[model samples]
Target: MNFLNLEIYLDYIKDNGYRCTPQRSSILSYFIGQKNRFVTAKSVTDHLQNKMGNVSSDTVYRNLHLFKDIGIIDLTFQDGESLFHLKNEINTHEYKFICTECGNTTDLNLCPMEKMDTALNDYLIYDHKFEVYGVCPSCL
Candidate 1:
């Protein structure tokens, strides 16, 4: 993945009025440099502990909240726990599939549900909750 995109996200938050601190930048770099989306605060802390020395869970939570506040990322309570991922990286709604057995996520490229976005906006007047679960290739 291109770390430059993460930098863009940082610039985005700044453009929206938030200061990008070193710890926050490290956390964002960890997220962007890593391949997994199904990650937790503990994992982030562990990853940062190696190079950046140590960081508290509070710092992780606070920075995550800041990312969420700017809409560059989003959090969800799925399967039984919290999950976070960049909004723009959230493949199309139809492409979001989660594997319950392995917790792996796959992004499909087909555009079959392109119309659903508008339909949901028209009927719900905002948007509708849409998520799907299935076994991923690795799990299956």
Candidate 2:
């Protein structure tokens, strides 16, 4: 396990007046271990439960929300379900293609928002999220 990645999350919680508990540690470790992939709360909960036993889905969701609040992760909706991915540390902007058939994600380099700049003028935009869904090649 990379202690540095875990430390960053622990330090963030500490700086924000939150205690670092065993559960929170495990959750952060899981995300760090599986970086660059979107995962559902049930998947996380099940994995932890198999090893630790008694890990609840609610606990996972609550911790996920905290992580999102701290800007360490971002959420996307697909097929009526919520999926999570770590916030990009380098480039914060990129549109994504989400595969509905297999839940795969592909980042697109082009920014469609660029074309909307002229049409969206006069509107103050603090942030934006863009994700399109379809069957991936392998899934198709």
Candidate 3:
């Protein structure tokens, strides 16, 4: 995915009825800089502390949740920590192999939902997320 401008993100926030504060802009800028990589809330908080002085983890997490809720970002869990990345495409299903040790991710070509379609014929499926977690080769 291409790097998006800060104003695009800020405009999305405004369109979603949220204020585009400097702190939130900074957070979005950080994610935009990260491109497709995932980051933890603690890392975002730490980065904000350096950039904006003493940002709380709670605030970072709240904004993260807001961004996720508004479809601006994607979320996954590794071990017990939450990880986030800017959504590469809106409303598109993504499958990934996530490295638990390093948080690196690689796209997966297979979609398990395709194989399960027969079993789920009676139920309507709206959305799904598939992630395989393990240490990457570099971590090994």
Prediction-by-prediction clash tally: 0, 0, 0
Candidate 1 vs candidate 2: which has greater TM-score? 2
Q: lDDT at 128 for candidate 1?
A: 33
In Å, residue 136's CA in model 2 sits off its true spot by 2.6
Off by over 4 Å in 3: 1-3
With candidate 2 superimposed using the best TM-score fit, by how many Å does residue 54's alpha carbon deviate from the native? 1.7
Q: What would the per-residue lDDT of candidate 3 be over residues 1-140, giving only the tens digit for each residue?
A: 54367787788889989999888999988987875678989889999999999888889999999988887888987668788987665436778887777767788889999888998899988778898888889999
Residue-level error in angstroms, candidate 3, position 110 = 4.5
Q: lDDT by residue for model 1 over 1-140, one digit each (tens)?
A: 22337678778878888888888788778777655455666777777787588778788888877777666655667657676665544222334566777655665556544677666665653333345677777877
lDDT of candidate model 2 versus the reference? 0.76
Candidate closer to the true structure by TM-score (higher is better), 2 or 3? 3
- Give the residue spans of candidate 2 off by over 4 A: 1-5, 15-17
What are the models' TM-scores?
Answer: 0.72, 0.76, 0.83
Index of the highest-TM-score prediction: 3
Model 1 local distance difference test score = 0.65
lDDT of 2 by residue, 1-140 (tens): 22327777788788888889888888777876665567888888987898688988998899888878776677887667798876554226547787777766787778877888888999988777788878889988
